[model samples]
Target: MALVIEGEERISAPVDKVWAALNDPAVLKEAIPGCQKLEMKSPTEMAATVVLKIGPIKATFQGEVTLKNLNPPNGYTIEGEGKGGIAGFAKGGADVTLAADGDNATILKYAAKADVGGKIAQLGSRLIESTSKKLAGQFFSTFGEKVGG
Candidate 1:
């Protein structure tokens, strides 16, 4: 099944600082919910291992993430596909935009699309949808709290 999610958050930092933190592997590892390992391969590619729990099921996902559409302190598109062995696969992408909320704050917005298959999808749309939203929320909240934002 496919899911669409959108939200915005204001960070107490400049747009450039927020953008740099977004691209930094260490910051991303700390900000991303359930992220266990993250390695940057190039300026725009990363390898990640994340562990997630949904309802009564738990799974570890190995994924490769890629960043596209460079716009400097503005926005970019991020995509990733992960394999969870017998639990199945999940793939998604998001278009993220950033704007200045003020001279010292930035507003970050995202329009994300995701899909899951196999056992993960069998958990029902409602469960998956809620979990996805929760994960996204956790990431952004952690991000906002870090990097002085």
Candidate 2:
């Protein structure tokens, strides 16, 4: 199945700072829900291990994350693909954009698309979509706090 999610957040921090936090693995690891490991392989590439639960299904995903279409302190596209063994696989990408709300605040926006298959997809779309939205909310809320304060 395929899923699409989009949202915007107002971060109480400068755009430059938000941009820096977005590219930092340490920050991402903390913000990402259930992220066990996140390590940079190159300037635009990372290796990750994350545990996720959707409805009655839970899985550990090992994946490669790549950053593309870099535009400096503006935004970029983040793409990732992971294998979860019997749970199945997931591949997705998000187009993120950052705009200055003010000298000390930024508006972060993202539109994401994802596809899942195998056992996880068997859970149905509603459960998967809600779970995905919750995860995304958690990440940004944590990230905003970390970056803003």
Residue 48 local lDDT, model 1:
97
Q: Which lDDT value does model 2 have at 51?
A: 98
Best by TM-score: 2
Output the TM-score of candidate 2: 0.98
Clashes of 1: 1
Q: For candidate 2, lDDT tens digit of each residue in 1-149?
A: 99999998899999999999999999999999999999999999999999998887889999999999999899999999999999999999999999999699999999999999999999999998898889888998899999998
Report backbone clashes per prediction. 1, 0
lDDT of 1 at 116: 96
For residue 12, what is the lDDT in candidate 1?
A: 94
Q: How does each model score on lDDT?
A: 0.92, 0.95
Q: Which residue window of length 10 is worst by lDDT in model 2?
A: 50-59
Q: Residue 26 deviation, candidate 2, in Å? A: 0.1
